[model samples]
Target: MSSETTYAVEFAKTSRAKCKKCSDIIEIGDIKILTTTTGGRFDVTQSFHPKCYTLPRKFAGTVDDFVDETLRDTTEGQILPKERDALVEAIKTSSSATKKSNKAPGSASSADAIIEKIKAMVDDGENEPQTKKAKRDDHYSSNEFVAAYRVYQKEKNDELKDVLKWNRQFVSGTKNYLLVKVLDGHVNGRLARCQLCQGGRLKIDEKNCSIVLCNGQFDEDAQQRIPCTFQCSIEDAPRWKPWFTEEPSEEEKEKMDKLEADATGEGAGDSHGDLASMKKEAASLEWNLSNKEGIRSATEDAIGLLKKYNAKLPEDATKAKQKIGPVILAHKRETPEDIIAALWKEVGKQLSNEEKEQKDKALEKTTKVDANAKLVAAFQELSEYYSKEANQRAVFTYSKCLNAIRGLDYEITAENAMSLSKGKTKVEGIGTAFAQKIKEFCETGTMQKLEEKRADHA
Candidate 1:
């Protein structure tokens, strides 16, 4: 065996890589053979499915010698003796078939003959009657259909039109009309009627792929439609239960009633414009300039109304009070009109500030998530590597650190890495070793330990 070429047997961690021999996907958690060929500076690695793997013709060794030489030290006791024996048998069978095929060109080998026999058996089974299998639609319940309908209703008008066009239905209609047409096609189509009617007065129109009532009645009529009395033979429930719409819950009904009341202005006393009314009243007040007492009384009334308006808006109330306080104290120097104008200006400024703050917070949160995503991915790779090596303690430690990083509320940047990892408010589960790795990643965008692991595996 050459020292430049080495192999290891392990289960694949992902389904993204293809098998070198068969050119098929090596599915996740399936046994695979990893082949590493050392070059000048880098190592190239290839993976192959267990059954597709073949021993090198140059290697003159027994099956046990090959297995012992290929497997890594960390995976020595992990693979069972029976699994090794199975692998050895598979390699021998593959080698024997190759030699037989080479000796007799254009002739079927033993493996090929066995495969043909299996295929013929499958063909014979296909010629016989098969038990009917349930459909994907039949598995869904009435609530599930209602949920899907709700999602359909929430789609954009263009999306709804596309769905209708794909289903070969009329697409020129309002959103609600399109939705109803699609729903009708699914619920009242030929298959639904055939399943529910059970050979009743309904005839299938093969050309149109539709079902029509034999009594010349339309399916739109409540009584003429498939009767609700039809029972399902499989579950002893209504055969068309999945087509039925679910009724609104109490909370949904209450929300609908509240919307109706607001639209009609019924039992909704001044809740809509109370603040505007108060502001208008304060602005419209007439104070006699000659009478100081009357001006004082008018000022007090205006202030009271402004306070009432502030009370109605809890989110802006505190800021509004701060703005109104100065105006209230300066009532003796400023006129009522000036006082009211100043208070409104302050309210506008506060609202603008709040909006800006909200936008900044949203941007910050987005940046934090992007940064954390990279860190989490790196940690996950390390965790997976440790898991494959059967280092349970390292896997657990890395998993805990990854979770702590994900739970962080702020982004860990190069400038804040030290504070987050070693300062007073250091993150939990991140010890000295993990913190060093995190700091290195934040500064260099890669961890040395992770790179070394990849190089070794390669």
Candidate 2:
């Protein structure tokens, strides 16, 4: 054994960097290395939990682009060491080039500009890296009116909160205002039917969400509210920022103040209410409960773990079916084709004659529950048996599982890679010059676009 040691490091999404110490996922800047120290034990390199890393990842796009471009400049002799140092200092101190005082030409508003950039990025097509739209509560159902109406019959003139289910849920302070919110499992999917379309008979757009609107006229000098007009700098929310910021009602604010006072002892002044403390607490509490444990009961754990593989279920099934499908596929990809054929043959027996035709391959086996269960059990049992033989065999099984997961996701990318990336089934009109377009292709969409163009000219 040698006292000297070397280590390998990798940068990862905060989601990937789970702190070994606290089991909280590490974020970008607040990342930790899963390192073995002098004692040869695993340790997390983060002093602050995953939450503080949230803010850094907010500017991750800018930071990464700047770092790469800066380093490239250093190599190209376009940037001096002094300039590089200044750039680093600027990044260290999060300086915002606030355009509050001056809006760019052709821009409607600063926030509109951010949204436009996001929209432009999307139009660039399937292959381009995309961030989801900033979520907002864009729609409302009349359920509240019905609920409030029920209560109104009982107490036509009751104080707020006493109005049964109404509880004066309507926001106060700003009259003639619309508070924007993300559709975070809020509102009924059925009530979202477009009132102007199909006489509002359909439940929803199904393809896209509806914009929720709240309209009211207060008796005390009726005022109307519009959409939330606050703007953002990025094309999307900072990964550190929660999906939405809520305007606390006067009552909620008083409650929060009272709780903070109680915790700090009235008049002790919110000394513990520091921003740093708030950041760390937010990160630690996110993974407060383990989905991993809750999943173990009904084969849900297996399905949950598959998410770690980046696999999605395009079909409907039970937890066992979903778990078993991937497990069997893992086994098939690793084992001999003849053995897999044999397994499918056994699986084919339980299916109807019509489905039996589909039973010649691994895909066919998964369509039937008994066959799926049999295949998964077979693989799991094989993995366990292999583990008994040697650590080397166990390693092979683990690799097979991972490989199967990757293979499926890659297949999906390749099939739709070109169209998804470019929104075209074939690439045309672009010449040898455009051929340079694919020096860095990642998804299947990009591949398809190239293959079509390449084949055309080849």
Which candidate comes out best when scored by lDDT? Answer: 1
Counting clashing residue pairs in each candidate, in order, gives 0, 17
Please, what is the TM-score per model?
Answer: 0.25, 0.16
| Residue 268 displacement (Å), model 1 | 10
| Candidate 1 residue pairs that clash | none
Candidate 2 per-residue lDDT over residues 1-458, each given as its tens digit: 23422222233445665654357666664322232335335442442232221223334465435444422231345445565454455444433432332444233322233224334433544232232222121222233322322332232222322221121132232110111111211222112111111011111112122322212111211232111111111111111111112354677656545543432222121333322332333333222122434223323433333333223332344533543443444443232322222223222112234323322232222222322222222333333333333444453543353223222322322234334224443234222222222222322223343344333322
Q: Once superposed on the true structure, which residue ranges of model 2 sit more than 4 Å away at CA?
A: 1-43, 46-84, 97-458
- All predictions: root-mean-square deviation over Cα? 22.4, 27.1
